[model samples]
Target: MEILADQTPLPDAIDERLRSQLTFVIEVDRLKTVLRQSPLAAAPRRENDAEHSWHLAMMVVLLAEHSDEPIDVGHTIRLVLVHDLVEIYAGDTPLYSASTDQQEREEAAADRLFGLLPPDQAVAMRALWDEFEARVTPEARFAKAMDRLQPLLLNWMARGGTWKSPGVTADVVRARKAVIGEASSALWEAGQVLIDEGERRGWSRSGS
Candidate 1:
């Protein structure tokens, strides 16, 4: 008797768009342009787009214990994680970098990056992404605030200032924190203490 032969046959390949899940590879490569860790950390030191997103995601989890407004932690976390994908196209702006045309440039970059998805997803992602960009809603505003707050916290603890490396002042730190603090008063209060201490100790680029 002849040995039985296997009759397995491969299924037809699925196209990228046809599958329920879509690939947004375009955004992935472009994301390399975004920088994190700020100029204060390495003088030109920067974390990649992926690292920056993860840092925000972790902050949502770590800082949850400190939020006072009964925020939707889940949504807040999600908001932070996805907010910065625009950097892939627009690149990360220096915290204190001045620009009259920055907003328009970022909006265009967002359109290109988020527009890569299929129609429905394009709309959904673009909406959430825009929410983070606009910082109007509670979620967007809170997440945006934290976005700035986290890095500042690090620089403060390290006795460094990314913006200060150029010409940032104590007032500038206060102003940057103001936008984020407005989103969550409690977070703002907690952050203020850090700023005060930073100033008291002369926590500039030296972190001393």
Candidate 2:
């Protein structure tokens, strides 16, 4: 068995370009350490940023058909993969937690993390992250849909995972998750069914 370590030496023949690329790749490994509030269905521990991004990428592949408009699945996958790399430095901000400085922290993290790559690759990576943040493109919108839907599914499976938090209610969940409908009506409708059922089961409260 082998472990991945940033200290591993690169070949002497590797140029500065490849060196920078590998450095950026190693830096992103830190995302695995940044955990989120959503718990894994099979485990009590919370999921990490890396796992969440991977899940979104897979969701993009499997659920692109549900998007409101046509989207390039590959591009959307790139959006999901790049979306959370900033959390390597910015850290995960729970969806329900209020944070006035999250955007500021993430922007700084993006600059430092993405800057580790070669200039061209850095620009491309930053572009993907920015596009996802903007949520303007069809792929970006659908990527966001998958991002929101993943946690919603996880919470339902965990019997109101995040919904168990103080002040979280069915209405709050639906309001926060309504963005899912902006990209995928089908998923939003399905999510609404889950929220309604969750409230009925007392997994979540009726109001704040």
Candidate 3:
């Protein structure tokens, strides 16, 4: 499918708004190509951005009751879905990669990808992405928690997945996964239990 730029003319048969929407739909399909650091439980390859986002969305539906505060599950799902769409352009930045300019890179990607939509949709999609990043609302906080939790689950199942990568230690996992507590104390406690077990099993590296 040809992704026409904003200035490009649309075919007479289709509306400009529909053309822009379709272009955006096609563009975001690239998200399936952006691979993440966390390995999948059922597959040998690492999970892609699309799979990660979908898993988080399902987590919101199944685990919303564990959220510290009441949240709109529907809105939380939307937050998770939009959260990673920018990765299509910015590429997945591994949690432990420690890249200093991640926010800047993602912000620019958000602009370009969301700009593919019509004016109103562009604003709405950008708003969802920003909300997920800010994590101020209950839904946003819960969505962010699920985002952190998903990788933790994967890594644990993968016998330390990214946890086995260089520079990662039990302490680093604790520090990175602490955000899960901000949304759900229950999930945070469970994740801590997993880390403890992982450490004992030699699956996770030790020391700070």
Candidate 4:
């Protein structure tokens, strides 16, 4: 028996608008290759930017009620989903490491990546990404909270996840998660419990 294949002619009807959108769709697939420091909850392997974004999006839905202020959950979800798309070019910077140049690099990545879409979509996506970074709007704040929370939750679940790294200390975790309290005191409390537990269990380094 011969192997069968569907031979189809090229559809010339596709236009530049759609071609640009498709190009962007293909380009963003690279986000899966941008590895992050946080490990997956279900496994030991490090998570990637794509997985991190989807995880935060789901977390926003699951934990929306915990936000201290009323937020547009839909808009918040959009923020989480697109917030890290720039990492496709800039790569994931470890949460514990601070780099003065990180924001500039990510801004350039955002400009190039979002620029792949049509003008209106490019503008909308860029705005969402920027809003999340700015953390000014209620939705942005809540989205930022969830983005911080998800990795912490994963670390807790994975028994210290990235906290085992040499430079990661309890103080570092506390400082990094401070924004969670600003958005959701309830979620912040929950994160505190995990941090305390991690310290107790030796999953995180304690202050000497």
Instruction: List candidate 1 segments past 4 Å from native.
Output: 1-12, 18-22, 37-44, 205-208
Native-to-model Cα distance after best TM-score fit, residue 67 in candidate 1, in Å = 3.1
Please identify model 4 stretches exceeding 4 Å from their true place: 1-12
Q: All candidates' TM-scores?
A: 0.79, 0.94, 0.95, 0.91
Q: Can you give the lDDT of residue 33 in candidate 2? A: 90
Model 2's TM-score against the true structure: 0.94
Q: Give the distance in Å from residue 22's predicted Cα in candidate 2 to where it truly belongs.
A: 0.5
The residue ranges of model 3 lying beyond 4 angstroms of the native Cα positions read 1-10
The best-first sequence of candidates by lDDT reads 3, 2, 4, 1
Note the residue pairs that clash in candidate 1. 31-88, 145-180, 159-207
lDDT of 1: 0.67
Q: Candidate 2: where are CA atoms >4 Å away? A: 1-13
lDDT (CA) for every model shown? 0.67, 0.90, 0.91, 0.86
Clashes of 1: 3
Residue-level lDDT of model 4, residues 61-112, one tens digit each, is 8899988889888889999989999988887888888677899999999988
By TM-score, highest first, what's the ranking?
3, 2, 4, 1
Instruction: Give the better candidate number (2 or 4) by lDDT.
Output: 2
| lDDT per residue (tens digit) for residues 51-75 in model 3 | 9999999999999999989999999
